[model samples]
Target: MGYLALFAVGVTKFLLGKNKNEQIAMDWRKNAVQVFRQEFDHVGCNSDAQSLALMQRSYSEYEYFASGRQNVFYAEANLSLRKRHCLFTTLLFDLTSQTEDLVQFNIPLNLPKNMPLEFLVCRRKDLKGRVSKLTNPGNFIKNPNSKHFKLSEAEASSKNSLMVLAEHDEISNNLIDQEVGLVLAKYGSLINLIHVTDLKQYNNFPLFLRAELQLTSESEEAQYTLLGLMLRLADNVAAYRMSQTVVQKCEKSRKQQKQEEQMQVKQAQ
Candidate 1:
């Protein structure tokens, strides 16, 4: 059979019948407890929820929550194979803020500060405007506090020179630049892990650096890497907000806690 057919058969087999699917899905709910763990009693990926809750493809988004200084950050993605996303990664970070979406900065290995680095600023078209120079430091790159999600892939874990190929590879997503953007710069630290995208629909959430894996490779590293990034992002964002920010912080709201407990009731029904 074809790949698509094989995938469907695999899912059906894994899920079994509707009754059995519910059992498996319920297990997802139980494991949904933590998308990422916390060092302290009240931090980490406090929640890990899959779309199987509703079993709807439209809702096939994974909601991984990380506590921030002020609010909860959600790292979402759809692992559905039906979607024709090349390499099939649709990771997005929801800060749950109103920050307007802008620029999709495709980073390079070595980024110098103050020099002209081609930045695809906020302008939606046929991906027009061959650009140069990064003006908005907040978006392109920002000075991080002592705390930031250590993106290992961008550095070593995913192998050194991880970004050496990113500039050349096509990130197949609507929010990414159709073409690569590289330029010179000066006085910029290597925040090479993340690239900003303009795909704003989920409340001004900034998508973070994804763990890119080969489409042909069936290794679970991609999943692990994606989750790791989510956790790191959660840590970085939460830490940044608490330290550099003054707004409200994510404190494991009572409502959220109750909802998690309610999941057990939901499974019973």
Candidate 2:
């Protein structure tokens, strides 16, 4: 009777352990679902059906957040699932503006310690132009501000270079002609003119009106007025085209010079 009681107690202990393990597994699955839903909501997944499909395919297992820690867990399983579906696992933390001053957070987690990362600080509008300037400083310094002027001075101290103006807008023929003459006198290069052809009906109204009036048998007086307007437009278009060609040629020359310099440096090295 003593041996049988001992055996029954051992069996009860085994069953209790198994039940506890099962409960833990259930909790993990539930937590994983919750975490995925929260992340999905944070990322605005509802707006896109494709994103929702990605989430469904990528959410797999919930690894224990941390040993003995209920709050944190490894998103490794979900990340792997996402990778299989060609989806990026981006973790975005909601940080308040004041949080940076108060909290310490690890940057670029999971990346190699030796990996190089570049941070660019600038107004959003200046990003493209600043990048272009870094490649070709002389051509980029058309309107120099205090910051750029300092940069220009540094460049000048290092190398003798000429500053060139950016291509002029050619929406108006008269403006193009004026810019072309100025460029020729200053830089002695053909200026490239950029004529933007706006396709909107309202934008082309003046030209369209003249063409229609001329084609219609409205009156001899109307015909004469329309013809004069058409002649003026033709002259404007011709002038714009010529200026554009000149500017393009100048730009080509500048590019060729830049290429030659690069080749010279390569040869010297």
What are the lDDT figures for the candidates, one per model? 0.27, 0.29
In candidate 1, residue 84 scores what lDDT? Answer: 16
Regions of model 2 farther than 4 Å from truth: 1-129, 133-137, 141-165, 169-245, 252-256
Error of 1 at 261 (Å): 47
TM-score of 2: 0.20
Give the per-residue lDDT of model 1 (tens digit) for 119-209.
Answer: 1212112112211221222222211211212233333233222222111111111112211111101101212234332222122343333
Q: How far off is residue 48 in model 2, in Å?
A: 23
Weakest lDDT window of 10 consecutive positions for candidate 1: 179-188
lDDT of 2 at 161: 29
lDDT of 2 by residue, 1-269 (tens): 99898677656655664454344334333433343344322211234411222222212311222111111111222211111111121112222121110101011112111111111112223335534533233333242222221223544333222232222323232422443323323321111111112111223221211111101222333323322322333333433333546456445655675797799999999
TM-score of model 1 relative to the true fold?
Answer: 0.29
Question: If scored against the real structure, what TM-score would every candidate get?
Answer: 0.29, 0.20
Alpha carbon RMSD to native, model 1: 18.3
